[model samples]
Target: MTHQLTRRQFGAITTGLGATLLLAACGTSATPTSAQKASAGDKFKKASLTFAFWGNPVRNAYTDQIIKNYEKAHPTITVAQQPGEWATYWTKLSTQVAGGTAPDIIQMDQAYIAEYGGRGALADLSTIESIDTKPLKSTLDEGRLNGKLYGIPTGNNAYAVCVNKTLFEKAGVEVPDDKTWTWDDYLDTAHKLTQGSGGAFRGTNWFGADQELKIWLYQRGEDLYTKDGKLGASVDNLTEFFAFVQKLFTSGDGPTNDGYATDIAAAVEQTLFGTNKVAMCWMWSNQITAYQKANGGDCALLRPPSKAGSADKNGVYYKASMYWSISSRSKAPAQAGGLVNEFLNSTSAAALQLAERGVPANPDVLAVVKPKLSATDQLAVDYMDAIKDEITNVPPVPPKGTSTVGTVAQRHEQDVIFGRATPVAAAKAFKSEVEGLIASA
Candidate 1:
């Protein structure tokens, strides 16, 4: 389906991002022409900075509150928010980056950070004293490319099984212990739940997403991309993973029925689990609050079932959900760094931020935010704490040439599921296609 940018989105890009992205391309620390020049050692100067990000209405609301707090604190700086949906955000940012018009402050993701950072589009964040590095010691490296810090993690997130408590109680199945559940056990329980629910709802909705692929790889003590940025899993591994995805869709006794394909593209609020049509599904723990707001906090988080039935050895890891990055070509690099500091350490931002961007990375931010959290938000935070010892370090960024890996993963997954190719053939072709991308890059 074709999607059109809303009036607000169009206005956001044309009115501000165009100019700012051009500034990013210029690679100059030229101050904004209209702002008052500041004294040498001042923390901030009077300036207008543009911050770009991807989000829906809910996240936009949170950001609006955060930005308001920042402006109130630093009365001279004004910020224009450039928000876009996930589907279009990267594409637009790429055009802006290539043409030298990237935003002053940008929301960076694991996939594209390397692409932009390696190409000198993102500022080296290590030189900025405004951004505190101590709090993010655990995850700081994930945002680095070749030892230069280009971004800072906004928060942490984990992929897990999300249970609909209301649906589970009605289906008469006991919740499985996340610590001990195995993939085999998960399938059996899903079958029982699906049978118990009759035709009104299914046990879960199977989704073929990159997040799932990563979790599956991690469970086997392997990774999707090696530290060197090459494809890590072999064709046999890909075949096994693809076959598992097909089983999830074809097995009506468990995770899916007829709606798996359609459901894959739906928003969080529209998913079967969110609409209370399923007992369980895999999702990022940070999304708990969004789904909870949609269906009430009648949901719970569990570690994804492990191959060996133990959470600790499952190779479960915490990923820095997203990041704050500055443009190498930004007009006001220092002020932009200060704004990034406020974004990461502000008490007001902490109070307003929940797991929407994942749990706060700073201990101080998490402490301040936890008391103010809604029940669902607390669950996300608590889940991370509950599994701290089991959590591994963040995965390596997918290298510069693999930003399109998500698209490649989704396409091959669909081909296998829809019978256009056998799992083995698809895996072979997928390995070839992905390796070729790395080689050409």
Candidate 2:
């Protein structure tokens, strides 16, 4: 399994605007009239709208039901629902944007919101009065770029370690209790776990650059980029991180960068942790379902190991998941805004989000849905909840060209591990390149 971003990765880099218009279903109302509301009758004007998102079939089904319910309640508005697999969603959506036929409402990854929103592709939803603007009060406030709210975050996500309990037991290594565990404890256990398993297994596997190391650096009181959009952190932190990974690589404790990439793609049962080759792996919280599918045996989630010798109580920050935005070119801005509000604030929409989306952003939705969540989903919910108060900052919307910077940071480290570049040289080069990207951004 190559753990790389899918074909949609291209969509991250380019913009396009070619897509077919999907009209809302038949007899849908266009807008709500005062008279219609006074009569307690279906008042929404007859209108057609399209919503586009990327997800698996289960998520698609849940979204469909949400749309169906909205249609039933209004009876005069028709919604055309479009779902794409991760591999194709970005490319297709980019094409729609380029062709000037983008969906009225689009589900967007937070990373691209800055680039697209900055380009006038996304409308400022704050201007719409139909939105509750309360449940997402904080979220909406952050999506603002140059003083406009372009996207609304759907919910929060964060990276965590998922350990194979069976592998831990088999290796005679103890899994650290989440609340008390530190980086040393995790690494110490990992060292033993890999050693005891011989060459057949390792301690951890996954992308280490931006996801694992940057977060670690933050916990250590450093950041990758500066407030002025220049390089902020020094090479020392990255060098230290690479040295640790190098030790793991040499000791056969962690897969090499390439090996880790393979595992990412296959996500197969035989790839280390999936096949019981490793004891731990880093994954987004939303991945619990995939992990459960790949490895049928018992597994447990844990916090990322804390930084060494740090007083900062917060080790991990909540990642605002994807954002929902309306195309500035959309003909039905008000209708799209209404849909966004309904999806985020309604009981029925909450149910759909619980089953399909990882967690709803609305606290009210979460309150109603928590009791019904599956064990894995509830784990994500609880983990995010535990860190909610501690989350200090959300990484700002990445600049246009820097979408590649996060991935490139990983490659630079890979080059160091492969002995293609010395750590200092790699760090210096990375700093210069990232600073240049931001400067041009």
Output the number of the lDDT-best candidate.
Answer: 1
Give the TM-score (vs. native) of candidate 2: 0.85
Give the poorly placed runs of model 1, Cα more than 4 Å off.
Answer: 1-42, 45-48, 56-65, 75-80, 85-88, 255-258, 293-297
The models' CA-based lDDT, in order, is 0.75, 0.68
lDDT tens readout by residue for model 2, 295-394? 7757777777775532234356665577788877666666676777777788778866773554677788888889888887777787777766766645
Q: List where candidate 2 sits over 4 angstroms from the true fold.
A: 1-43, 198-200, 226-231, 256-258, 268-270, 308-314
Task: Write out the backbone clash pairs for model 1.
Answer: 21-100, 21-101, 21-102, 22-101, 25-100
The TM-score of candidate 1 is 0.85
Worst 10 residues of 1 by lDDT: 31-40
- Clash count for candidate 2 is 30
